[model samples]
Every structure is written in C-alpha cells, then in structure tokens.
Target chain A: MIRRFIRLLLLAALVAAGFAFWMTRAVPLDEDALAGVEGDVENGQRVFTAAGCASCHAAPDTKGDDKLVLAGGQKFPSNFGTFIAPNISPDPTEGIGDWTAAEFASAVMQGVSPEGQHYYPAFPYGAYTKMKKQDLADLWAYMQTLPASDTASQPHDVGFPFNIRRALGGWKLLFMDDNWVLKNAPSEQVTRGRYLVEALAHCGECHTPRNMLGGMDTSRWLAGAPNPSGKGRIPGIAPGAFKWTEGEITYYLETGFTPDFDSVGGHMVAVVENMAELTEGDRQAIAAYLKSVPEQPSE
Target chain B: MKNIVTATVIAGVLAGSAALAQNDGSAQVKARQGQMRVIALNLGVLGGMAQGKIDYDAEAAQNAADSLAGVAMIHQPTLWIEGTSNADREGTKALPAIWEDNADFMTKWDAFVTAANDMQSAAGTGKDALGPAMGGLGDACKACHEKYQQSDD
Candidate 1:
C-alpha cells in the first residue's frame, strides 16, 4: 500500500513538471524579411485606428483627443476576474519606449512580452498575430509620436489559478497559431477583409464563442456569443448567424440598420461608431469577409 | 408651528409624485414604443451622415436632427404612468427600473432632450461638427437603454 502511494506521488510530480515546461516556452515572430524595413509614421496612424488599440488602452470614459494619451486604465471584466489595461505609453519607465522594434512586433503579433512572458489574450494578440510586419512597424512608429504618459500599468485582479501567467501558455498552445483564421480565400477583397476582421479589427475577441478554457472556438468564429459585458447577446455576424447579405452588412456598417430595420443597439453601437470612421473600402472589405466566413448553425 | 406646516407640505408633494401611477401603462405602451422607433430612424440618418457613411447632405441631416428634436420634445407624461415593463407588456424591451426609478428615468429623458437640441443645431453646420454631436446624442440614448431596457442576449 505504501509503495502504491509513493508511485502515485511521483506520477503527479512528473505531470506538473511537464505542464511547467510547456507553459514557459517563448514563441517569437519568425518573419525574416521584416528586419531591414523602415516604418512610416503616417501609415502607422492608420494601423492604430484599424487595430482599435486606443479603445482598450486609453483611460476609461476618455473622450475625443484624450484617447491619444494611451495611459491604460480601462478595466475589462471576465469570468476569471478583472483585467486592468496596462500602460502602453511612451514613458521610458512605465511604457514601451525602451522596447526594441522586434520586441514590439513580437509582443503585438506573437503575444510574447519583452521579457518573453505571454501577454493576456485580452490584448487581442491572437488576431494581431496575423498582422503584416509592415503594419506592425508603422504602428510602432506611430506609437513613438504619441505623448508619453506617466501613468503606470495596474496589476490584473484575477483568481489564483487564472492569475498564473504561465498557465496561459497552455491556452496559447491550444489557440496561438498565426495562420489566417480563414485559410482559403476566394478573392483578394475577401483576403483583405480577412486581414482586417481577423487581425487589425480583432472582431473575434468579442464575437466568437469560447471553449471551457476561454480560448476562442474558431470553428464557430463570429457566430456570436453572450456579450462579454454580461448583459446581451453579441449577435453572430458570421455566415448563417444572421441572414444578412454582403450588401446588407455593408449598409449596416455604413448606416447601422439591420434587415429587420433595427437600429444599432448595445455594445455594437460603439463598434459601428468606429467602423463608420473607416474608409468605405475598409468597411466593404469587412462586409465581404463576414459573408465569406464558413457558416455555422445557430448556436 | 409655521416650520412644521412647510415641512408637511414638502413631504406631501414628494409622496404625491412617488405615488403618481394612475394606470398600468398598457394602452400607452405601443405609442411610446413607436416613439422610440421613430427616434431610431432619425438617429440613423444623422448617424449615417455624421459617421461619413453617407455624404454629408446638410439639409437632410438638419431634417433628421429636427425630427429627432421634435420627437424628443413630445413628453407623454401619462404614457409613462407606471407598470410598462416587458414583464407586463409584450413589445417593450424596457425594464421595470424605468417605472421604479421614474425620477432617474426622467433625468435620462431630459439628457436626451438636451443632446437632441445640440444635434439639431450641429447638424446644420456640416459633418465635422455634427459627428461629435451625434456621438454625444448616441451616448444619451445608450445610457437610458443600459439602465432601462432589456438586452437581447
């Protein structure tokens, strides 16, 4: 009986050791061609808007020009706990000023921090992982021009098991590949739309359903889920989630009306506010991408 | 003796407003809901122009904004006479919080009036000015919905 107990303890130890090893692995960006390119500040600003980085990182309830500060105090609530947005300001001590371009690219695309730690997916790096390297460089250049804020990033208020950043490695292992969410594209427009929706726009961060572990279920991508806000449904915009045609979807992005003539309501109202600002082609690309996504039966 | 009389009068007024429910808010529910739909229509026009989704037609925007202002001005005090929640009615997405906190609900309505008035003036100026004004008005509508309306989720 004592020998059996000892063997059980050893097995448990081995399992724990394996998980630790898996969780600490660093995944860096592998694009070799991006190394020598210089980033453009003008295009970087465009990337900033497309990525919607300010919405999460800016101070909560900030309006108008204040969004440019990027001091990072927005709080996002989740089943695990609350996540406070970290400072992405240009301040040397509190922000990313000291980060190398490669570090920024890796953090933004590969979800690896400067210290080689995994950033929380709340940063939406899963979608960013598919971002083009040039865009990343431009975004980095744009960040350089923003005013450096003195505000510090706050610690996340998560539960014990969820709080362990290392554990995120396992979640990353399951969901962190950099391939396009839609592998086969029918057209260049569809491909552009995919890049916008999957990478820069990061629409799936809210729209897609998650598995038990909180990694997005790409199979049901954009099929809609309960509002992360915990109030209403986030309405699936994926194929078959609603019966909207490409034109209707485009019209809605432009005018905020659905087929039933329901005006934009809920959290989507804010999203439309952003999409409305994008160029007409950008909005059309998003519409095209939404139409092309493989259909899933209503969840 | 004089002080006590004034205090009693004040308390009486407060109690009267608190007990102001004269109906179950049934007959007026559809009218009120229809008012909400019209408001959304006006908002769509202004919002489309403001977001640059549609070309800025100053006249069209002004018309939409004016319609919004007109709708916001019509206060059916009797229509809000308590008990008009989704629980009691079939079409509403309104929560009982609207009736329970009538004073707060009216405050939100007042905000809508103020925002609509601002948008009414701003819409005539063209896109750049109207955009922020429309955003302010959208927030006003959203604030009420967040507190008073039931979400579809």
Candidate 2:
C-alpha cells in the first residue's frame, strides 16, 4: 500500500511539471506573415511617431531634435520592478541593428525575443500586439534610418520570482490579448481611432488598471489606475467620467490646452508632444474614439 | 487711563505682528495662486475667442491680453518662499524644484512674459491673430508647469 501511494504521488508531480512546460512555451509570429513585406520610410516615420517609441526608448530628459535619439536608459519604476529601457538604436553591438524584420516583429507583436525568451509586460507588447504588420515593417525601416547609439541596455531590477523571465510566459499566456476593447466602432473615423488608441498610442497601458499579476484588467478598460509612482491616480478617460467633447479632446491633444485653459501636466506633457506630431484629423479621430469608450469610474 | 490705553495699543500691535508671522508662508502661496487665477480668467476670455466659442470682441480681447501681460510682468519673489512647496505644505501644488531650479523657472517665466507681451500686441488685431499668440502663451505655461507644478488631477 505504501509503494502504490508513492507511485501515484510521483505520477501527479510529473503531470504538473509537463503542464508548466507546455504553458510557458514561447510563441513567435509566423514567418509567412512577414514575407515579401516592404517598408516605406515616410510611412515608417508616421508609425514611429504614433508609437511614441522615443518617448521611453530615448534617453531621459532628451530635448528638441535630440529627442529622436533612441539611446534608451530611462528608468520606469513599477509595482513589479524598475524597468530600464533598452537601447533600440541601430547599433549592431548594443542595439537591435542585427535583428531581422521577422525577429523584430516577433519581439514587438508576441513579446518573444529572438533567443525565445518572454519579456516583461512593462515593455507594453500587449498593446503593440494589435499593431498591423505593415506598420511594424515601416517602423523597422524608419528605425534603421535614425542614428544609432552604442549604449548597452541595463537589466531590470525585479526581485525573486518576478526576475524569472520564464515565468513571464505564463503571465503573457494569461494576459496578452490582441482583441479590440471596442468591438463595434461605428464609423471609419472611430475605427481609425480604435487602431490608434489600442494599437499605436497605447493610451490604455497607463489608463487601464492591472490585476494582481500586473496584466491589464480588460473589463475595466481605460478606467485608470493608481499612478505607479504611488503619489496619485492616473485618471480614467472613459466617456462617463472624462466628459470632454470630441472637439475639446482634439484640441487638448493638439495644443495641450484644456477647455478651462489649464495646460497639460505630468507624463501627459510628453504624450501631447507626440499627439501634436499627428495630423489634425488623426487627433480628431482619437477624440472621437475616446468619446466612444464604455464608461467605468476610475478607482 | 493713559497707561491703560498704551498697554492695549501695545497688545494689539503684538497680536497683529504674531498673526502676520504665522501666516507668512501660506499667504505668499495664496497670493501667487490668486495671481494665477487672474491669469486664468483673462486667458479664458482670449481662449473663447480663439476657439470661436465666443464671438471675438476686440475690446474684451485687448483687455484680457493687457491683464495677462500685467500678471506676467509681476516680479514678487516673496510669493515663493522656501517652505511653501507641496512637500512641506497641504493643498499646494508648488514642487520644491521651483526653489532648486530657480534659474530654469525664471527662464520659463521670461518666456511666458514674452508670450503675454506678444498677446497684448496681437489680441486686438483679429481672432486669426489671437490663436497664434495663445499658442505661444500656452506652450510657455506648459513648459513651466511640467517642471515645477505637481499635477492637480
């Protein structure tokens, strides 16, 4: 009876180990999706601006024209850990210059690096996963044109189990959804707005609250979260709570001026700078889309 | 009777001085805040015209611009005492960076002054002229706030 009991316990442990391995497997984008794709530098520039790549990837406090430099090393403190931005410049030694288009797409869209490791969600690949393949290609082309920085990427300061990159695969499996929060966008403008908000701009990365596992709680999309800095809340921009007209929202994005004449504040100052680079119509679309989001009070 | 009257006068003077000393930091903060509200009030009028929310009245536009320029020209250093930062007080959004980075703060102030002066010149010309002037003014306000002000929201 003792021997039989020990055999059953060993069998259960083996099954559990196998389940963990299967769940933690890296899933990259299909190579066929990237085949024959050509990148246009002009459109790439647009995609780059919309993604606000330089906002985080650039060196902190980079001003004016130097804002274009993708030297990285900006420290982003979060509940999980402090993520040090990687140097994504075209430097072969320190940046992604050696990465192929397929490798880049997999990293951006699937959160799987070329070496088959899962990246922490702090990089916000969950939102980028919704991005169009063409846009990703264009972004790659545009990135290649920018000047490269030789700055080495720093390791994140996450502790214990959070430091284990393999565990992030399970985290991604549970949370990395590419589905549109707004399933039925009413118009072409609204549709474009959805793409911008969901895919390109990643406004939800901050606005949407996360679960205990640090994945976005999609049920409360755009309902805002506690400012990770523990100082204040990142306010929700959902229609019910935000209450700004489409025109007012567009103007705010373009000029950072509210209806009350107060200027934009905090991290939004950089967001507005990026939004200003977009076309007037694009800003209008963002406003319209924001107006369409389902209402949820920012807790 | 004269000695009693002098004693009362001295007591009153001391009480007044004590009150002044106690409220100095907060008073300075409130005064600067009041000046900011004055700026906001004038900007609202100009902004309405620029956005076509309100009809462009040259007189109203000119008046608002002049008021904004006047506030911008204020050089009251006492209104930013060291202990009045948000870190040290309640219900204030003034960050300590204001004192630490005073040179940058002054530079931003200079920019706002320039923008306000430009608005004073351009406001009465036409609504078309008001928009560009407001842009420069808004940018200057934002530049300063981004650095030294804690976000209210």
Please give, for residues A1-299, the per-residue lDDT of candidate 1 as tens digits: 99999999999999999877866687766545368878999999888988888877888757567888899998888877888998898988999999888888888887888787888888899888888888988999999999889998999988889988887888888888788879998998999899889999899989889877888988888888876656557778877757887777876775555644455664455566567778889889999889888887886
Model 2: per-residue Cα lDDT over A1-299, one tens digit each: 99999999999999999999888988887766688889989999999999888888999878777878799998889888899999999999899999889989999998999888998887879999999988999999999999989888999988987998989889988887889999999999999999999999999999988888898888898987888866667878887778789998898898888878878887788888889999999999999899888888634
TM-score of the A chain in model 1: 0.89
lDDT of 2 by residue, B11-67 (tens): 999999989877758778888899988988898999989989999999999999999
Off by over 4 Å in 2: B1-24
Q: Lowest-lDDT window of 10 residues in candidate 2 chain B?
A: B144-153
Candidate 1 is scored at a TM of 0.76
DockQ of 1: 0.20
* Clashing residue pairs for model 1: A232-B153, A233-B153
Backbone clash numbers for all candidates listed: 2, 0
